[model samples]
Target: MSSSAFRTVPASADVVIVGGGVMGVSTAFHLAEAGVRNIVVVERGELGCGSSGKPIGGVRAQFSDPLNIELGNRSLRAYRDFPHRPGADIRLDTVGYLFLLDSDRQVSDFAAGVELQNGLGVPSRVISPDEAGRLCPYVSTDGLVAAVYSPADGHARPGLVVQGYARAAAHAGVTIATHTAVCGIDTAGDRITGVHTDQGRIACSTVICAAGAWSARIGDMVGVDLPVRPVRRQLAFTAPLTPPAPRIPFTIDFSSTAYFHNSDDGLLFGLADPDQEEGFDTTWTPHWLELFRTAARHRAPALADMRTVGGWAGLYEVTPDHNALIGRSAELPGFLYATGFSGHGFLQAPAVGEVMRDLYLEREPFTDISPLGADRFRHGAEIRPEAHVV
Candidate 1:
């Protein structure tokens, strides 16, 4: 099968993934490796053309929940093992991540999150504000009481990771439809039998809805309302300064809302929006710059001189609890739900893909998916909220 084969022919399959982001491609690849062919992945746009292509490239295991810790750890392993590629390697830089202690409550919760990450084999620890400055010489440590530092935390290029998964899936004979969009679901009785798409209809027994920001919309098509909504996140880039500032780590100021890192040519930066708290809008405004500037000054005053070269907005598939909602949907049989990743989708994609594969192929899940299942929401189960949800 060639790259353009799907464009020339209308094909059917045993499984159809309804969003071609990192989740869809990663699942398709692993599923193929599990010996289940006839897999078709449909994307509303080109692969990695969604938020997968627009991430700030953050990867870390510093979460309060053990499930997320496991997910982050599992995905980090895969990233560590990704075969070396020339040109644009997904630079896995372990420059460390420090979540600055903001308040007493923030400090207490970070202690718990660090303990959880450590229990799950993550090398995260609590560090004094001075230690935070040691890791990133440019960081402003004034009034910063303490920090939660994860030395194992780092970042990888989003486009490279997406392409790696897509290439591996294609090499394994998985049908990856780049420009296809799943319009709706074709159901008979209580089970899904096929998928309705703009290109044509696809006959399949199992369907995985990995459609990130559009997850809620996809759920509506199948009568399963996924509580996933897109919250716009803006990232700004700066031109390289002289001497490169000694390879800074990905630092987050819990005291403030600032986060910054060293990119290839320059540095990448992001901050929380002061407005809405959460929403599904990708529209950008000047207010975001204010938020970034205010946070940056409180965290690292040196960054105040850095002028923004440009910025782009990406939607975070956020849930009510700010954690990913993964598992089977009860309303729609033979259909599984895997979205509402909040902002952890990219880092957790590899593990989430395996979780989906295990559920679909009847293999033992790497970890328990019961906690993340949609049934929890139906039964009024609460997802444990993490204070360090960056």
Candidate 2:
């Protein structure tokens, strides 16, 4: 069907991903590489042009949930070996993440997580304030008692990573049709039928709701309500200073509620605004800038002298539990979800795809993904992660 057509034509497939962000593209890439070629990825806008584009590129294994810990660990390996796969040369910067611990309880809790991560083969370790400064001297170690540092964790170019997945999926015979918005879903006898898109109706046996911020609306199309809500996050960067300090590691200042990493030529930074921040709105305000400045001055006094370049707002599809709702949706069979990631979607994409394919196609995954099931939420089983430095 052509874009000029008034009516959307129908195309058949095994799966239809509704969003073209890293979550959707990465899943398509993994599934296609695993031999599931009958897939169609429909995006409402250009590839990697959503929350994925605005992510501060903070990747770490500092998670409370064991599932997320395992997932992030696996994704790290994939990023390291991404170039081995044809066309997935997304440059993932493994610069490590240093999270400052402001309170004793916070320090003790993170120490426990560090112990758990290390036991699970993740090289996460707890360090003192001096050690934090040793890791990055730019940090203000005044009130910082301890910090969690994981050299194995890092950040990648979000847009390039999404493009890598989309391209890889395309090369593997998976159709990536961007700028093709999926308006609603078609359903039949207790199962998914097809997807109604701007281009045409794509008929698919399995419908994977990878539409990040729009997952709830997509779920409603099939008469099921997904408890996913979009929370707005604004990110920005400063002009480059003289000779970069070996690309500073992803830093999280717990006291300031701030986190930042690299931005190609400049230092990307962001913080939550106490006065104005939340809900589906992605608008940026001058007060938000003021809050970010307060954080920068407290964490890195040097940044106070730097000039603000620009920034943008993106949404985090947060679930009630702050964990992603993966696996099949029991309310709608043949309908799977890869949404409600809060903000961990990009880092968890590769592992998520692997697990999703293993569950949907192979019938059994290596690990138990039952915790991520939507039913778990209703059952009061939460997979709340430890790394809450959003």
**Best-performing candidate as measured by TM-score:** 1
Compared with the true structure, the alpha-carbon lDDT of candidate 2 equals 0.77
The digit string of per-residue lDDT tens for model 1 on 1-390 reads 234425432457899888888888888888888899898888877888777876458888888888888999998888887764212257678777778775778788888877777778999888888988988887888777788888888888888888888887888888777677777888888888888887788988889989998888888887887887777878888877666657877888865567888886777888766464566667766567777787777778888768767777878887777877788877676888688887788999888988999999777898987888766667888788654245
Candidate 1 lowest-lDDT run of ten: 1-10
lDDT of 1: 0.79
Tell me the TM-score of each prediction against the true structure: 0.94, 0.93
Show where candidate 2 strays beyond 4 Å: 1-10, 274-277, 385-387
RMSD in angstroms, all models? 2.2, 2.6
